[model samples]
Target: MAFKFFDKLSQDFAELLNDKKEYNVVIEVDKEENMKSFTTHSVVLRYRLPYFDKELENATTNENHIKTIIKPNISAQIFEIILKYIYGGIVNIEDTDTKTIYELMVNADELELKELSVKLENYLIQSKASWLKTHFSFVYHSIFDSDKFKDLKKFYNDIIVKYPNLIFESEDFTSLQETALISILERDDLNVEEIKIWDYVIKWGIAQNPTLPADSKEWTKGNFKALKITLQQCLPLIRYFHIPGEVIWKKMKPYKKIFEEQLWDDMTQYFISPNEPITSLILPARIISNPELPSRVNEPFSTIIKNEHVAELSSWIDRKSTTYSLSNIPYEFKLILRGSRDGFHPKTFWNMCNGHVGTIVVAKVAGNDEIVGGYNPLSWDNSTSTSTRMCAKDSFIFSLKNGNIKNSILSRVKENDNALRYFDSNEQNVYGPLFGNCEFMMRSNVSDFTQDKQCQCKYMESPIFQIFYNYEKPIRKTIELFSIVDYEVFKVI
Candidate 1:
């Protein structure tokens, strides 16, 4: 038979026991199972052990711990209701407010039956059945007023220490809203990481918020401050999988400048390292060269004219001749003059110049273009294909700052005939094609920083070289090729 049948029978029996006019009966406290199993109509009275010590004593029997009989002239309906609650953790439709359930669990906890209390609390939270949300709010108010639940606090600590295993088996959400709600209620102390986890959940809806408001008499902004500090601390710990550092910044950007500033330091630790790949790093705008200043880059066939008097040439060559624009005014210029035409124009005049007296020229910038023409003043030492041409413009001199990579770079250029050179220019050579087109594509100016709220696109234009040498004047030049890092001149190869 159904347990409900025994429950009704128990209620009827209790009513009979309570009536003074009816015959009195003695009951065995341990005979409860007989009532439930015997007759479908038998009245079986069941009462869950209450918080009082007397209730436990009253419910217990000498022979068996689980079996018990109750002698009460209780109302049949009330007895039935209570009996249902004891067995099923719920009762059939009746007017019972959420406050009653909350109180019952509280009493259960007080009675040292923590398992039942915690289980019921968890069920309520999961069911979204907390009509007692207001009651929890009141509890928050009271807890906010004083530090109570000292024993429960100790239990909470132990529970957290074993959280991984305990939580895995439990039905609670990873980030429980009640946790924050409870902390707000009980003046509970939570560390930085815990608070952060709570804040993330609450903001993201994985957890619920506490009932207290910022302006309530019981409310204080201390929790908000704690939440902020928690988020700030978590920013660095989140980089284990190499997420883009900028994403973290975007999430935390609304904070005051001081907070935003600190986040940079935290993110920098993960974004920069000698061994780290360039693609993984996110550097501030300051480290890059200004796209507006094209001179920062070095390229093959580019020339730097330290002497301001040397005529600088424009990037384009006249279609009719082998000579590049001007060959005398000193300034950086592209050594390989490339355009639609690429054959020997016998009509073009070549003014041979000696190296030591003509001007110091460098070649092999990291780009593609022809290395010889009428503008290539340095004469070849051997047959056309066998000789290395001296670049009037594309190149860079050796320096410690730009990786001192000139010599090795020059050697590679001579051997490959197709390598672009890169180096830093500190202004000694004015005739060099100041920088390359590719290098100009990756940077911006510092003045634009405040104007940009987010990282912006680099819409820099391509490089246009203007010759700084005077081509009209006849000159003698000796052709010599130097490596990008090893500044040695290349012999005929």
Candidate 2:
């Protein structure tokens, strides 16, 4: 019986040996504090080897078959996190670990790994770290639309309140500055009026970090390209103050050509089209307020005083057309005016009144004016009750003459000897800090530029003035035919 039991026990022990197996898995790591190294295939393998293989480092005879490799450039923390990702494909969002994720995102950006960067950014946004908040703001601003970052508005508001000067304050923002500035402006609650002041601040910043001509080729080209993109982000807000990036950019001649080329591209498109005639020619207008309380002497002054001529014309155009279609006006026609910064608006007004010989009212009686079109400012007010009014009580009839025809245009541009050649005839308020360069002609050039002769010049490809002159012939003929019917009626006006 004892021999039979021994035989059964021996068979059971052999069965137990058959069920056990060994794993020879390889796991490479940066540090050995949390891992063990082993040898395999006559090569030194530094990894988290199995316990049986952990004793492989004890075999010095195997050193001859071993390779000693340097540790990876990764940090221990990163290595462990990477290992975690390798094992479970997941990472924690805690503050200590979140920084590692951010660095990963930054590395992803450097590597141009779009999916990785996006995923990391999403994780950082959820982490809610204050600095991460700023970073994610930049990432979201660049990658997505303004509304996508709306949830971060309170964060931006807090930053702005704490540092009101932060809008212009730039550090090494990498590739995201443009999107960040534009996104900030797009927030409806933010104050747009502060844009000019912020622009000046940003200008100062760029000037301080001025792109010098002697700079290395890469910086001059690449850095300046980035700077230009940032400035363009400020374009929409700058329009409100008529302060283009060019105003500050001209001083930095290192990137002058680049900036000019960009500004030309942006503004030129708006100017080239015939639809936005006034906007094309006229710079943005300023608003002036009467700070002093009205006294008995000055009580009639406007509460909000401004040059309303442009606004008046814009309103009229808005009213007359459901879709910018000026009645009887050619689709390709535009009315242009030439003026200076000091008195541009008023000068533009005067240009409307007496500057053009072919289009002004004086052409009917004296053959000395040019009439582009006439407007009753109030008739153009889009807010009018009827919405289609064509006349206003306080109205002015102004016109445009041929600018390409030199002699006729010269007559209307009266020069003043008192001021080294100034257009002293037109009386309108003006202010200056002239941004763009414009050429001026002495008064004698006005009539020459306004003549009705067919343009033989190759540059005047459109023949704009010829079109204007012919279009108004019916109106002029009506006046002339009316005078013959009743000669006494001509004296009324």
Candidate 3:
């Protein structure tokens, strides 16, 4: 019974829209010959669409109380569709192409029809998700042109992250607007390495000037000068510290003239002095590398990074998965605390380490400038006995700063029953199941620290397979990864 009433109401409104000639106003959508005019009643326009009502009030009128208005940018075809929605509240875009729909959406926003614009935006996202993907660059440029399309901007970027090739390798990549290109570089999940991204950043900078040669090989000092102007805002966004020392001295050395002297000095120190605390302004590792958040992340601990990087990490921790659709955890790290600042005594870390289990402890080798750390799956209470056994069974130590992991000792694990454990930690940073006293673990344990009897007195526990540590470079190139802990204490919510 209720359906009948709505049906009749719809029919009446449809008929009213069709009988537009009887109205006292005419809205001409375009000035071109054979242009279209919309017949609409001022009363309906005033009550439903404020833009039209205002247009009518300001509209030039004739003696017979009739008024005509012109809409300069909108085409008659789009107005025909918009008028129907205005009078009848029905939008039948059947068989409409994504381009026309995008045009219609743009017109809708200009007309100040907030609800209509939103409905069109949602339909474009859901119904034409794939089409949007294909036309991502065009769609993004359209959104970038106007700040009013905030939803479209986010929607476009969400898709960009899933298929980065759309931006990185697509023909449109070099031609993208400067802001759009910067947006791509800022994302952590870009699926490209920093070196590759740096190369691309150069390509984009070189593409800006048609007067300059397209090939960078032909570029002169003047070309670099021009590109420096274009990439001034983009230069700082790159994570220079993440790039290897050799690459910086070789590949980036060519571009060093553009960098500030202090910044260059900072990079020089960062690459040369491994143990020295970094004071330069460098961003911590990005928090979310995947679309979904991971189930677990290292609780905040000190490394080389400072407190400024925690806001993003904390936000990720608060929102990441507990058990739902899990995410792939990236091997990125952030600096949290340094014994140089926070004190080396184990009790100094008691408040940060006491309650948290699953804490990842990373320490820089004092003399060799190597990075060594372990993952603890159990809590670190002050009362723990030196004889504490490997009950958690998931704890393990690894070498990342340098050196080959001698055996299958430090394989990344999702979960395991036979994990390494540690005990006999003192007030200093020493605590691992691989040994009961102050000592190094694995093959290098016998190298120097062991030869010097670094541990009070005890043979370091042996792993199922030997692990190794080397400072200059890892025995296996793949092992050359280390993250400065950004925040020492964080938990996935």
Candidate 4:
């Protein structure tokens, strides 16, 4: 057998990537403020990627015989990774963040780098499965925009079929792509009721045409035609004969103008005489099953803290002298956001937790089991342009006892006017929940708290050397900055 020396060959080409002497292609990436250019050889790109092959054919060369390709959408970081892979036939994501890796996969697919895209897609599904679920909504909507990533589509579709509400009840359900909607409807195992599916389809169709009257009863024939045309692809996927006759009359009658005369007559006749044959085709009823709830739904409320911690936190919220027993906690801890599930970005915090009142923000310190958190009695506002301090007499900051820490500490607000600090909209991208004058705060310049160690629990003293504590005591024994393993924001209902 012949020997293989791909490692050496790869190393040689990788070194070539750094050589600026003979490059003939320049690629400009990212928007204006962050735009960056890279020099490359066209021969490497022409043979390595089909997308570049076509792009290079159409691209005109300058007098220096160097061709330029402008890609404002792709980030410079992602392109750098792609460029290395193109020349070296190697990819190293060991140090890259999961979000960056995901973006690289998307960009690779766009550039027709099927091998790279498929490899990254499989890696994400196998290694970063937790991250994929945490950013489920974004991932689901993004994959449907194109026909690539079949395995990812199947992976998410399996979850959607079991928990139909994840997609159907989402806030942006109406904005779902037509292909995605049809894929769900085409599923024989979709567990939702037929009537509800019909309603959602009608809702989706109506949302596409804003000019249509609010009331279907006030609709003109033209409006009906407009809606029918919008829903033409979706209409056929609905199981008409499967829905109850009463529901048909109640829901389907108003939109009768959309159906052909023969189909409508056939449906009506089928309902009147069950034994009669009809010209319209009848699709099989969906295979509905009351499957056991997925582990995600049945999992404990918070992955970072247990029920004992919840009881303790609840007792503190109501200012109870004694910790409430597990069975008799007064308030329910309703989780609105989880750093591991939603995202670790500070902006994700403002987007999801905005306007939420009576909230508790808990975070597990990295490299240890210690949990520190703050309570905010007022709503979190992301609309403000200037920094604003919320006033709450009952708000407090605390560190819960864990394996690494023996005793829990509670620090009620000593300064009522500075109980909580809400950052301006521009600063929200870097700063999350804040309490007092940097007494206990979550701040990340990199936009991801887990990726940075900027979050702190310090006790600051005034310039005059007098104690400038905003709260009664420090939550952590040592005043130091730390990263987090995970964080959760719950509404104390």
Candidate 5:
């Protein structure tokens, strides 16, 4: 067996990156205002990066025989990391922030550094998953623009498949790229109703052409043709044969001009006669999964609360004097966001529970059996720039009865105008669900609720704080802030 000195060789190559004496390539990166230039070796760049090889070929040399390449779109910080990886085969991202690392991965992919880009992509998915989910829209849209990150696409699509509403109901759903929408529609387990999917597709197509008439009945032939062309890529992906005949007649009949004459005829015939053969291709029905709930098999519905707690909470929601029975609870608590499963970051709460309405947020107090929570009948909005108070007469905060708690306390909103507080986009990183006058609020200065004792439940019984009592009573006996063991946000369906 032969011994190798690759370690020494790598170190030497890394040192060469700092030597400006013999470098023949001058690379300029970032925009004109903050532009930076780096010196590199042509031989190393040619072998390490395929993109650089072609770029170098077309580049003309100066009198000093140094080739210059400019990349204004790439930030100087990201290119510096890439340059180091190219020369030394080392990427020291230990101190780099997640956003910077993501930018590095994108730049590496653009530079055709497959190994570096793939490594960064996997690292982001495995280690920085919470951040990815927190910035879901940006990450999802950016990845679909290029086909290089297949793993990231799959990682996000897995989440989208289970919770189709995350993407389908988002504010930017209309702005979604055609390729991205097609990829989602092509999934066999999309977990949305066929008619709903049809509606969303039509909605997306209409959004693309704002000039189209608002009423489908008022559409001219040209308007229909314009819509048909806009949805050409997405139309075929829909499983026409699986949609109910009534739904098809109600929804699909309006857009009949979009479909090919033969395919539409075949669909009509297939609906009339189930056994009749048709020339058009028939896609299998999408596997509609169970309603949105915790997918963990053999796991309890919640770690903090149980069925009894759910019944009590249900009673509170319905304004009933007595708790409902376990078998006859009026609503189902569909798990939307769990701190343990999703993340403890305040931003994670805003990201996952943005548009959800009628949500129950329960948090397990650290080192105690006290389960403090609040019910918000209004939807959580993360799109606003300023903090907004939601008006709700039914919203309330409560302390559920558990091991040490002998009696449960429920406090309904005293001030309907200030029932709940929705933090602005900037403040979302520090604050989560806030109920009346900081009565029941989750806050984390370190961006994690579990790591800090900033979560507060102010005692409203004190005379000095009487004016700030937005709820009927304080959920906690003490006014001091505390940390939480875990938290969960469930949509009351």
Candidate 6:
């Protein structure tokens, strides 16, 4: 009932605003050499519009006690819309073009109709995002030209940050004001190389001079001086030390006169002797460009393991460490198999673990609930011809305890040492004769450099060391020795 009453009252007020009458105040609108005038109720003008209220409050009374307000800049079309909104409590901007709406935004801003101005800005952003990107030059010039449209300024600034290359490489980059260019240069995470940034700066500076030669070979000292003058404010913003030494000595040598004597000498001396302190006390923060999160789009590997050991093993391979996330990892892990779920025999497991490169193995110890995994970058083969497929230096094993990751075992790929190589296992030729330079060994009575036999999965080839349930070191036996908690297999693509 209360809502209905307010609704009726609103309609009546709107009807009252629409009613035309002989009003007391005259608002003259001049546009395109045409003079137009609107008569408005003085009461409504003072009550509805703050701009008019301030104008009338400070205005001196005429002989006939009439107020005449002149707006020479506003067009008749825009004023008509504003007048309707001022009188009828409705802003009907439908079917209006972007330019007219832009004009209305300006007019609304001038009239202090903040709500209507916000509405127009939102409409432009939603409806004309593409057009705005295309005509960034016109849009940037118009918005920054006036201090009224703050929302518009922010909208453009955000889009510029997301796709900075669009503006940085555009022809209008040279026309960008110093403040605008500084805005782009200030962000440390602006995804661009230092060399590309230097090139753009030089281009923008060169564009500032009309008399400058197009070919850099024909550049004169006067042209360089002119460019330096144009880029004097911009040069300080660039991290000159971060650029390559070759580029500094070769590309920037021509512009040496531009830099202050002290700064140039400091830069040159710093390159010569990096250990010595430089003039600038600060260094640029390096860009944090870690890989983005992986997409589960192309048939992801997900498991609901019943045992805690298998659960944690599955968690680590999919880049879900309790302490670390996989956002920094560049590979997408796809489910290849699970040892307990697949019910693979020892011979089947060996055959399956042979030739698949980039495989990760997560084994959970039943006694201590310690999770261990190995990353194999090279595939394993059964050939005893001293082949390159024997044991890889890139293969590494890791341990996860209490959700923290630690590197447990790594292959000793050292020069003048053939210790961590695969040869015929004294026990069996199919899966034995595993000798490696593995760290944190249980026991290696085989030799000083060569360790005990390591297990190899024949199909998915990687050196594997067995983990005992109640003990760290297992006796020289196959998978038939102890009770296993669980194990998971993953392929990193």
lDDT of each: 0.29, 0.32, 0.56, 0.83, 0.85, 0.56
Off by over 4 Å in 5: 1-24, 31-35, 39-67, 84-100, 112-115, 128-150, 156-163, 170-172, 183-187, 260-282, 289-301, 305-493
How many pairs of residues collide in model 5? 0
Q: Candidate 4, residues 1-493: lDDT per residue as tens digits?
A: 9999999999999999888999998889999999999988898888887678777877779999999989999999899999889989889885687789999999998898989999999988765553564455567779877788999888787667766764665546787778778888898899989998999899989999999999888999999999999999988888888888888998899899999898889889888897899988899999989876522234587898787888788778756688766544445567899999999999999999988767899999999889999998777889888888877787899999999688899999988888888888889989999998777899999999999899998854443532577888788766678999999998765
Cand. 6 TM to true fold = 0.50
* Candidate 2 least-lDDT 10 residues: 484-493
Candidate whose lDDT is highest: 5
Ranking of predictions according to TM-score: 5, 4, 3, 6, 2, 1
Looking at candidate 6, the ten consecutive residues that score lowest on lDDT are 467-476
State the RMSD for candidate 3.
21.0
Summarize candidate 1's per-residue lDDT along 85-196 as a digit string, tens digits. Answer: 4444454422344445545455445545566666656644432221222133333333333354444344344333322222222224324334443342222222223324
RMSD of each: 34.5, 32.9, 21.0, 14.3, 13.2, 23.4
Clashes of 4: 0
Give me candidate 1's TM-score against the actual structure.
0.24
In terms of lDDT, the poorest run of 10 residues in model 3 is: 468-477
Q: Residue 315 of candidate 6: its Cα lDDT?
A: 40
- For candidate 1, the 10 contiguous residues with the lowest summed lDDT are 484-493
Across 251-315, the per-residue lDDT of candidate 3 in tens digits comes to: 88877766778889999998889678766788655433545422233443334322322322322
Candidate 4: segments with Cα more than 4 A from true spot: 1-22, 28-36, 42-77, 84-103, 110-115, 123-148, 261-279, 299-493
**In candidate 5, which residue pairs clash?**
none
Give me the candidate number with maximum TM-score.
Answer: 5
As a whole number from 0 to 100, the lDDT of residue 400 in candidate 3 is 47
The segments of candidate 2 whose C-alpha lies over 4 angstroms from its true place after superposition are 1-76, 85-98, 104-127, 136-190, 194-237, 241-493
